[model samples]
Target chain A: MYNLIMKDVKLGVPFIFFLFPVLMGALMLIPGWIYFIVLLYFCWITVPNLFNQFKAQNDLMFTSMMPVTKRNMVKARVLVIVGLELLHILIAAIFGVFTMLLYPNLTYLFFPPNIGFWGLGMMMFAIFNIIFIPIFYKTAYKFGWALFFSVMAAMLFAGIAQWVGIQHPVVNDIFYGTGAEQVALQAIILVTGIVIFAAFSIIAYRLAFRRFLRVEV
Target chain B: MLALDVRNVSKSFPNFQLRNVSFQLEQGYIMGFIGANGAGKTTTIKSILNMTRLDSGEVHILGKSMAAHEIELKQEIGYAMGGVDFYTRSKMKTLTDVVKRFYANWDDKTYRNYMRAFKLDENKKIAELSTGMKVKYNLAIALSHGAKLLILDEPTSGLDPVARDELLDIFQGLVADGEISILFSTHITSDLEKCADFITFIANGQIIRSGEKEEFKESYLLLNGAENQLNQVKDRLISYKINSFGFTGLIQADDFDPSCGIKAATPSLEEIMVYFAKKEDQYV
Candidate 1:
């Protein structure tokens, strides 16, 4: 499995790709940008670019020839996706810290850069994983529809969560209120979101394995 | 134990079907899989490697079920599917590094020796290599890991005579120790003629004939005559073709008719495959 992970690593992506999230993270530095859009940047750029690398090289054929199981291939692929997702998020979080430092009291139209916000990002990614992986694994070749549905789903989560933050008095107050009260609410959402993330990701892995077996590569 | 035993293997596509194809390669010999394009040659090879799912059948490699032991079986089998290159955009070093890690028996000395002998540049991207160079590079990788069985699909199709001969020599060398076995599918009959110990011919997804190479060589007779002589031997001929000047046909050596204006010559593997590929009786 480690070898399988290294296989994707050696098929190095273009340098321009690694820069995508950092550039998106820079958007948060703006005085009053909606942070929800910044979260969308991770899936929008990362998934499409990763799939392109796969299609261009015909990666499944290469991996199938090796002494690895189809199950392990899915495991390694999920790891790579999650690894990149975390990398992009970390870069954005660093920029989020800077944005907060620069404008400590800015009015946030979207959720502020708080622990719960990242927690929400994890849930959106989980939604993307559950939808994208099984559908894409069906053929393991065509990805347009998988990307389409997953993006819509992830964006919907971000959009709905933003609306709740803006309009619901109780939810808005809990998120925007002073440090300790907000921290307590945020901690709850974070734990809940992490739970959803882990659960959905496991479901995606099993679904992907079953669908991938039927793929005729 | 036989190196390979494909029993009653079958697969189906919407428009075609591979029905009950079977053959075996004993522990230390070569089996030449011959067929025309779309003749299920590639499909059979894919099934053996479990690259394609088989609807019904069993493939045993070195006495283990290929379906049940694909991952473990692969460690000892070196497979190269023709025309499909691996990680073509990556450098040779990058691709092989990933491949080498999977085989516990991979020897750096053997890999370097092959690299030097083939004059392969480690940093060169796979896509940049010519067809012959790509085949050589693939062979180097397959041979470096102490693979017990080499399954190559059409490794000789698009090479100059010299390069093809070179590859055949390498295969012959590998099996000389009576430890390694080979199953190479090819449309190029001459390569098989040079090194194959056994032969299996497939047509329209069915195995038409498979046996020892010596038996295969002596079983069929190539008959030659003028165009008008086709009728006299039509019933006896397995397949026949009529050109402007002459008619050529393949018939079992025992079925030949001396009075049909047909003269018999030994049939080559290419002659046999050509006869089998055409669907209708008068296949011209």
Candidate 2:
């Protein structure tokens, strides 16, 4: 199962590389601090697409034929999602740091373009993963449209967050202000995001394992 | 001891339902699961593997309930599907590596031997292999796992005659050990006639008949006679059909009366299957 997850990750690298220029261009439009959020959106959308392909390949049937249990299958897929999420963060963080150094004077609207941004990005990814993975795992082809709509809804929520960040003065000061207080706030959000991601991933795993147990090949 | 015992097993879906399906396959025996297209052959296999949740009934493999000991039961069973789907980009070596990590008893020597016998290129991606080669690959994987019971669903659907014969030979060789049992589902009855020890017929999601191969052969007689002669034997017939040439009916092969001047011929498995499939409509 770990091998299977690695295979998915290897298969996804090409797509991620192909999206580099577009993702870099999108980053130029946003403040360096919030670039991580956009990167999170990219990871959220692309990882599921890769997993959708994996599911459609009928790996479940083949894997189930092995001595492995259905519970192991569900665990492998969830691990793959989490692994890909981390890879996305690592790559985006590298590019973000490069952008920050290249344009030092450019003002960041939120936390600095460093670990703080990656933290927020992880939080956003966690929210999407928790909601979407279990749903897709349950009714893959059947609830495909539902998963699509849910992804779109996540993107919409991200858009709203950006909008609110720009409009509200107090919200803007707390998030975009350049000080230790702002760093502390970002730290809290990052920790909360990790906690949420861990909690939801576990829940999703249990639901998906039980649901797939009943699904006919 | 029986290798598999499915006792009073029934599964229901919205459109189709399998009712009271029961059969037993003993060790060292090959039981052919014969059915038409949508006869629930795949469904029954899935239920036994615990791939699909069964509403009622129990499936026991090697004296253990599948529900209670699924992992242990599956470890001893090998399965191949009618339509095999693999990761197109991965090569056979990669697949072997991945599968080898999971099964403790995977025989690498047998795997290598099968690769050489089948002439399967280890470096070539699975998507590039022909359908026949894909089936061969599936067979190799199923066989190399040291499995005690083999369950195949339509394992010989699209192969040419030569390839089909080769597969049947492989199955025959595997059963020569006299400890392995096989339950294969196929629409092609000729294959069963060649290698099967027992035959089980299913139609309309029901087990119509199941018994030893020779017993099944002796139970039904395929008679060809003139229209009037067929009419004379109609009262004793289980099923009959009228065509432009004459009338043909299935009657008790043993009880067939030659006094009526109607010829009683030994029926092949195919003819027996057609007789049962046709008999259902007449009886219902």
Candidate 3:
């Protein structure tokens, strides 16, 4: 399983993908910017290209030939996706901390890149995974429709979460404020996001495996 | 012991279906899987490997159920399709590094030997290799994993005749130890004629015959006679073609009557396939 994950990283993903997190993370340095887009770049750019690379490379056929089960193949792929999503969020969060330090008194017009925002980013990726993985495995070789639907779902989650963080006073205060209690609430949200991410990814793996079994490849 | 057994396996797609495809390869022999294109050769191979979910029936590899022990059995089974078409941009060395990790018995020394024997340069990307080299590269990896059964699909389709013959020789050498068994699918029956000990012919998603190579050919007789005698044996022929010289057709040996005085000759593998295809065409 570890080897499959590594194979995905080394062969399936291009070198540009590694730089995407860092490149997109730097956008978080723009003080008070819409923070979700930093992570959304993953959905917008990294994912489509990655899955396209898999298709172009005939990855399904190549991987299926190995001494790996279809189930583990899906598991390893989900791990790669989760691993990349985490990297993007973690890097963006680091830059977010720098943004906070650089503009301590800047008036924020959006959800600040606090722990809660990163939590929201994790949630967005969770939704993407739950939708994308299973759908992609339907053909296991085509990704266009899967990418379209998954990115839409992720965008919707991000949009609603950001909207509530802006309009709802309690949610806004928890996300945008810098007080100790607010930070504590943000931490709770972050933990919840982690749980949801893990749970959704697991469910995605199961569903993808079942769908892949029906695929003729 | 049988190295591979595919029994009553079936799968259906919108356009094609494999109907109870059954074949078996004994240990340490090359079994040629011959068919016209779209004859379910690839589908049958995929079913045996469990790459495609079987609609019914089961595949056994080395005396164990394939569905129940896929990963474990796959470790002993090496499957390659045509050539190294995937990861074409990746260098052969990088591809090998990734592939070798999946097998516990992967021998780096053996891999290096095959690479050298095949004249494959590790630094070169897969796309840089020609078709024959691409197939040789795939074989290098398949052979290095200590695989007991090698299932290759159309491994020689694009190769020049000399290269194909070279590949057949390598296949013969692989099975010389009485351990490795190979079941390779190809329409190029001449390659199999040189190396395959057993033959399984598929047409229209069905196994028409499976047996020793000589017996497979010997079961059918190619009869040619004057146009005047055509009606006397028309029903007995599997399919027949007429020309200025007369009529030539394939018929089961049991159906041939020696008293008819028609000339009967042993048909080559290619002739058998052509006659089977003609039979299919005539029915259609």
Question: Best candidate, TM-score-wise?
Answer: 3
Q: Give stretches of model 2 more than 4 Å off.
A: A1-37, A40-45, A108-117, A141-143, B233-236, B252-261, B280-284
Question: What are the RMSD figures for all models against the true structure?
Answer: 2.0, 3.1, 1.5
Tens digit of per-residue lDDT, candidate 1, span A68-115: 999999999988777777766777778888988999878877777877
* Model 1 whole-model lDDT (C-alpha atoms): 0.85
**Model 2 lDDT tens row, A1-217:** 7755554444423356445535653464455545645555554456556656666676667766766677777787778767656655666666666776787787765455554445556666666666676776675435465457556655665667666776887766756665888778777766776787687778878887777766776
Residues A148-211, model 3: lDDT tens digits: 9999999888889888988999888898888899999999999999999999999999999988
Q: lDDT for every model?
A: 0.85, 0.75, 0.90
lDDT of 3 by residue, B1-284 (tens): 99999899988899998999888999999999999988889889888878788889889999999989988888898877785489999999999999999998999999999999999889999889988888788788878988999988999989998888888889899999999999989999999889999999999999999999999999999999999899999988999999999999999999999899999999999999999999999877
What would the per-residue lDDT of candidate 2 be over residues B190-216, giving only the tens digit for each residue?
A: 999999999988887788778998897
- lDDT tens digits, residue span B27-108, model 1: 8898999888888998998889998999999999999999889988898898776677766877999888888999988999
Winner by TM-score between candidate 2 and candidate 1: 1
- The residue pairs that clash in candidate 2, if any, are none
- Name the candidate, 2 or 3, with the larger lDDT value: 3
